[model samples]
Target chain A: MEKLQEINNKAALNASGALSKLIDRPVKMNITMADVRKVEELSPVIGPEEIVAGVYLPVTGEITGAALLIFPKESSFNLSDLLVRREPGTTRKLTGLDKSALKELGNIVCGSYLTVFSNALQVKIIGHVPSFSFDMFGAIVSQIITEFVQKSEKALVVEIEIIFELKALKGYFLLLFELPQFNAILRSLDSV
Target chain B: MMENIEVNMGDLVVTKNQDKLTTSAVGSCLVITLYDLKFKIGALAHTMLTDRRVSHLKRDALDATSSSARTREGGNERRHEIRDMKYVDAAIDEMIKKMVTQGANKENLEAKLVGGANMFPALKSDIGKENVLAAKKKLKEEGIRLVGESVGGSQGRSVEFSVASGIVTVKIKF
Candidate 1:
């Protein structure tokens, strides 16, 4: 709850404006707010064997937690060659319609960051059914922080970086709750 | 002794001489290293599952499904000296009882399994082969001595355990 970093940077720019209207392009998102360091001070931002292409969502009701969406295997085969239209590296080996178009583009960028965390923290969060891991960004974030960092050493990260066209894709949008569902989303952000 | 010791993701770390425990990528997640080569010690774990008593991180609903747990209730002494390492049977029983209370003998233990791969072959029972059969049944029921393994397939690996030259330098990534 480090002051919810400006409501997690406006919920990562409304999840990068819903991924620039469904990947039409020009999607740039940047929001880094980790006020809980200690899982070895995070650091190694994707390297433990690289690979990457994870998206383990779990944002259930009234703000529960978990939402990771990493991508680095050449930014997920260059965004799965523009999410399936194909060309560049021709979806380089990600088979089957480019792994279901990168899990349908990680289910529309994690359902637009859980609909901007349920309408900018109003509540009712939900992002279920998201389970995709291309693996090894240290074993998919070591299975995305096993048991939510054992009940919180303080984790509410939200570092998303998704620049498009010119090509750039980074990840991490973890938000494992505890501490009364993060003070119940900081008291429902004071009635939004 | 900070010679480059970094074991995040469920975490684990232990050292002795020239330290060097590293952990990266290792998809499906699993990197259990316990050297103790006559007290050069070692101990490195990076589990993501293979046992936390089979699923328990209970977040409520990931809708996709509520998630599993990683148990992080700390009081520090290095969190009870490297607690749970996020399961692989409670991180090789808490790094073999902290490497025999830091004297490390237990018959000169020596195991080195790294990154159980299987990235994502459409998921169905292959949490990297159940974290490589729970790290070879807890290193053969604690009789230790598994020697070495790079495990499964589907790329991504980046290990580096030295602990005074016991040597483990994997770097796959394909």
Candidate 2:
């Protein structure tokens, strides 16, 4: 537990730094290690049926899982405005360019965390190209969970808080690992 | 008074009173509801997968007969096998059983299907489609008429089923 906390803290710092540089604003990220839940019991990060923007990045190598970044409907619109450099509150709908920008954000933030994890565990980890979706929170989350449930029944929930330009938004980063892969991660970290 | 009940993933609920069964944020998952008007009994299931027979973990476990072998092959794999209700085929059968146990006549039961949406269009996943197909197939095999449906597409939906009226309300955001 302590080791995971340390790794999580480091990853959050690195991710925030990368995001801050990309957006050209001071971004603060706080990660709270939430509970390890049964895969079926993996609750929605936001309102289950609330429409939100989601970026899914699949991870492979030492472990197989995914990292999902979610922004509530309002936050997504606001973030899109900032990313596309439009007037504040001006992005009522996302264009192709806006979608690309959000996918890049997923890559940078999720990539940074994976980098730290690979270094700490000495495992080869890769985050694949991101896919973007604007849909119900329950739908997006459950789809991702379904992909991983065949291999693993436990999911780790990480509550993420992102603050920038005096505004704060809530996000969730979930990690799902197959039992064997999970055990391997633990064993590798224990040896270090 | 109409009571509301929330059905989570891999769960099913049956009631005969003036109650509403609801499940929200259904993406690729399928929500199956069975209603018997005469008895005023309704059952709802929030199922995530199509068939357990094709599950990799299940296949591996089946290949290994002994409990010791299953555990030795994968850490805690034996204990983590998903419940049968998580699959559409099994969930439908189970839901019907539950409705019957709650004083519903099998002949009067009609089914409604909701959800089965592909939330991420870029990803090549047919789980949602397969889940819908499986449910339809299972319902037919069981001789249950499918009265209504709101499935497919890339939009997520919320579903509410009222036993008293046998009405299913499906909603999507934009």
Candidate 3:
């Protein structure tokens, strides 16, 4: 019984260590209102409601993980218009081309945020191709959370709202860490 | 003598000779080809979306609706002048009309379907499923029989229709 307890204790410690290595220490990022302002400067007429931003850090201590940053349609469309330089009314609908542009924007935003993880975890993180879809803000957030969070044992969801002028673009970022990879990180840390 | 003709999306092609009509990268899209051995007439259509209320020509214009509406309106004249057309419904319709014009009885027409694949797994929306369902439903309503089909999967498919033998050979991603 004592031996079994010791083995269990070691397993728990290794698991915790992996989580620590996969994600930043605090779990939540300290993104200020000013950061939102800076992001808005890249576009025009950001949102009429407060924009939400979030980050998901994998807790599995894996060297590679997935990160997702979602933006509301209003903010997305505004940013797309700015990036593509289409005059207002000329392109009121978000067509396939507009969706592609938005995905590119998401790629950039997520890429920048991943740098923070790289510095914190001291591991290389590469991203897959980003995809974009338009829907109600709450629906998108809930769906992402439901699909990525509810399925995992323990997950962290970081949320923030960005307000610019009368417009607000809500954001949600989800991070998923591979369990096996995280275990390896913890084992390596123990050896060190 | 086998003629290899490329069928672009939203376009339809038909031939009675032993020509091969082929299209690449079919996703959430249906390729409907009809062959009448009696008249040696073959027709193929590549459609991205499914809708019964609209014609293939109208839908193709709508697919490119991002352009100015005026351009679309004015382009109609040029579109009409072109004999080759695209759109699943319109293509099928046009093919039927042409086959009849070329001595193919409407009652004798038979179709072989292929190439509806779900290329992007992450996309929760199943466009390929919808396309297949739409094609089946429309064909049934129009009194056309689907003799055989190769539908939904994760990989893209290349489809080829041989007019001479009415054989459709679908090659999965090499």
Better of 2 and 3 by TM-score: 2
Number of clashing pairs per prediction, in order: 23, 0, 22
Docking class of 3: incorrect
Ranking by lDDT: 2, 1, 3
lDDT of 2 by residue, A16-121 (tens): 8988898897888888655576555644346677777889988898678887887788888878877888888899988899888988887877787788878888
Query: Which consecutive 10 residues in model 1 chain B have the weakest lDDT in total?
Result: B59-68
| DockQ of candidate 3 compared with the true complex | 0.02
True contacts kept of 2: 0.83
User: Candidate 2 DockQ score?
Assistant: 0.49
Off by over 4 Å in 1: A1-50, A54-66, A70-75, A83-108, A111-113, A124-138, A143-148, A151-176, A179-192, B1-44, B47-167
Worst 10 residues of 3 chain A by lDDT: A33-42
Sorting all predicted structures by TM-score, with the top scorer first, yields 2, 3, 1
Please provide, for model 1 over B48-167, each residue's C-alpha lDDT reduced to its tens digit, 9 standing for 90 to 100: 676523543342221112132223456432212223456688788888888888888878888988866665544443667787888898789878889888887766688899899788
Measure candidate 3: CA RMSD: 21.1
Of 2 and 3, which scores higher on DockQ? 2
- Cα displacement (angstroms), candidate 3, residue B44, comes to 0.7
Lowest lDDT 10-mer window, candidate 2 chain A?
A38-47
Best-performing candidate as measured by lDDT: 2
